[model samples]
Target: MENAAWYVLPNEADIETPSLIFYVDRIKENIRLLINMIDDKSRLRPHVKTHKCIEVTQLLLHAGIKKFKCATIAEAEMLGLSGADDVLLAYQPVGANILRFIKLIKQFPNTNFSCLVDDFKVAAQLAEQASAEDCIIQIYIDLNVGMNRTGVLVNEATALFKQLSKLKNLSMIGLHAYDGHIHDSEMRVRKEKSKPIIEILKNLSKELEEIGGRKLNIVAGGTPTFPIYAKETDFDCSPGTFVLWDKGYQDAYSEQPFLPAALVISRVISQPAKELICLDLGYKAVASEKPLLNRVFFLNAPELHVESQSEEHLVLSDTKSHSYKIGTVLYGLPYHICPTVALYEKAVILDADGNIQYWDIIARKRKITI
Candidate 1:
């Protein structure tokens, strides 16, 4: 089907502008491809940072994806609410969040909740809290693995893993590394860049397992290295963006065939100039971290180029085009779907039957009754 046929909502009149719309058929297809990409369905612990809605989580769980990864407490709680089998709180919690993490575990007895640990003090804090509550929280060593964003270096991580194991109420499941920094348009380049880190993590897990006397579960990489890590049996692939893939990954990673499953509907509210049009979609509506040209790709109006954006209005201008008029609807695919999804309270889900329903972006909040 053409982009218009798939992206244009049949109940467009019912929905408001600057809304997040999910094409359920495409999302289901993406999940199918994601599972088929990996050898073991258990190894596919997809991240929930993209589509935090419980409905999407249910779709994944129904598709046989038992394990999941997320960055926030709300995401983990959201997973727990869905009766998720294994939920990894992929971020290292500190300060008050440590207690909140414990509360999540206590609240959701059925869901196995785990977290990442880079600092021993934080692990001890969590262990103390868990011990006090008489509950256990599973943890993965958050390794740096060249991201430099968070996590300890390999040398430190190896020692940290050994130290974290001795603590009570903290289950040392495996090593967790996010190679989100490795999205090189070319798969070969991505593979090449990811090799040393993958090897290091694998060797570390192998050595750690010998000491611990069990299989060390390593959750590694994101959408960019999903295919690369799919080749590794030990590493659990925790790609988040594949559910509602964006223009960035679609344009960068050609090897992965996951279709774009979500879109932002924006209407031309005003045409201030012959070549300038204003949209209801602004930074508040869609993700705005990328440059004006790369923020959102107008699937219908490829000619439209972003000129400026504020909280409530997005201005577009095309030097040679003057055909766009007020009330002209445009479908946009965000450059980064993860953060974009967080901008909305709920999504307008367009089901396979062309019916529209509202699904709360449940985990979008920082806290969810935890």
Candidate 2:
């Protein structure tokens, strides 16, 4: 317990319950580890969806990570706020988002921006909006590489890429393949799955260059597949969770030595029964998308199992017969840090000197002056 007490703050007197705690030292070490993982930092376009704070973005920018990928406009604008070198809005923006994206491009001219397009209609609409705004929008053809979520299939995507090349305000600059479905715990299986996806992207890139007469860039993979893609010279990797890792990834990928930098601080608010104690941590505090026990693992209280959870209360059942008082503090590691991070407005930052500060989770908001 003493050796693994890096997450424990010097004092929990000022912190509120169910709040987020970030260790700057661990985050800095994680950033250093990420930089040392790859040979060339230029090919690294880390996703900013994990820690959506401008301070963290500035940390990455300071650590020499220029290119970044994000899922929302507010994140893009947050990167814009930090003057990131190249930013990719990985999601396909539609309807009013197109204008908001264009506004982002116009607002942050210092930061070059691009987006993903899986459908031709969305691409054309984007091009029309860009034309109306009198600006060009760079895009990547989002490929469906077994994710089966948003990307277009390879066979139809080539023709669509050629078709979109004729559009005036659109520039088909790259091929983006997000193999998010390949998160097997075994490294061998993960490597086996990523090989085919890499081959397809390479072949498609060659075909696009030969036929469309424009060289294309490829940015693919996330935290799960980042290590596999890091070895590839051609494909860039955008891993988000490496910045502030969680229990889910740590338990899944033992090969990745990133430290758990972020945690949720919760105190026991009530003791309803002999073995059942309720903590202030709840669905509103942590990511509740996973199962009851899979959401958050108590770092200090391994004997506690999550019995139930509600909007503002998380009830846990004790097994080891450890006596816990009402105000006992429990530090937790979230299974899914991305969604868990979104629940907090400000992260209680713990520095190396045990100093406590606040950093706004800026991109948690849907709109940040986009």
Candidate 3:
């Protein structure tokens, strides 16, 4: 009695369509590798900025990772609310938005919260606010290790540490030195570049202790430099990207050890020619910063090439004359996971059978300016 022309209905929600998905098994394995790589005295304070998903955070928590390094107050707040006992805000807070920070403190009164500061004035302000609230705030001294980013110069960090020690409500907890710019195509070169920075940190730790300053609790590193720093340095590591390994990290290592859990599931919306195809997702879906280098990878069609990407369209050319018809699904591995994740509203979590289990995008819009 069934009609011969009946077609199977496409369930867009059940498929990984334009959504980032995390393979839980792969994530757990990577966490195991990270933990096994470290010594008994080491701790893993994985950066929460990479995934920013409470689910992924929960998985890391279950994997014996209690300490987390967050880029924004929102991320810290989210982790605190989601039952993360300790969270560190690894960015300097600016502006008059002290109310938001205070709210977070009050909301998670029992939780251990900290923030990074390069200047004593800002530390004093935060201490003043914490003092008014009758709360203690932990502070991390951010030292510049040749990145020339948000940290204070290595030579100037000790003076800043002295200033922070005077703040009544602020407790100097640890040091944070992130060498993000030294990642290279060669592992030896990257490790060699990080040695001087690690040496500076060791010396700084010694100087801080000599002055009878507060003991260092957390010495953190960003995700990209974790491998080099983990082996050489005696500090707590913070590598977030290892949870959901991306194409960029894979390319940098030149070895594909981890599976590409997060992918942009795009469909061919147009076919301009027999050898050319266009996709619906473009710069808005993936990162536009290093488009040519980071993006344009083949998952299903190795012969297909990602020629160009506009705001909303991706032009693909098949060099081997592989014709892609309209409505064909393609998976792309993004170069940078953080920025690409920030662009989406939701992520689809997949099961072992490639079935969409659930979608979580709760922290996607939890960005704070301060």
Per-candidate TM-score against the hidden true structure: 0.96, 0.97, 0.90
Model 1, residue 203: what's the lDDT?
88
Best by TM-score: 2
TM-score of 1: 0.96
Which runs of model 3 end up more than 4 angstroms from their true locations?
1-16, 351-355, 367-370
Ranking of all candidate structures by their lDDT, best first: 2, 1, 3
The 0-to-1 C-alpha lDDT of every candidate, in the order given, reads 0.88, 0.91, 0.74
lDDT of 2 by residue, 118-153 (tens): 988888899899999999999999999998998889
Candidate 1 structure quality by residue, lDDT tens digits, 148-205:
9999988877678778888999889888889878879998898899889888987898
Best by lDDT: 2
Looking at candidate 3, what is the lDDT of residue 86? 82
| Candidate 3 TM-score, C-alpha based | 0.90
Model 1 CA RMSD to the hidden true structure, in angstroms: 1.7
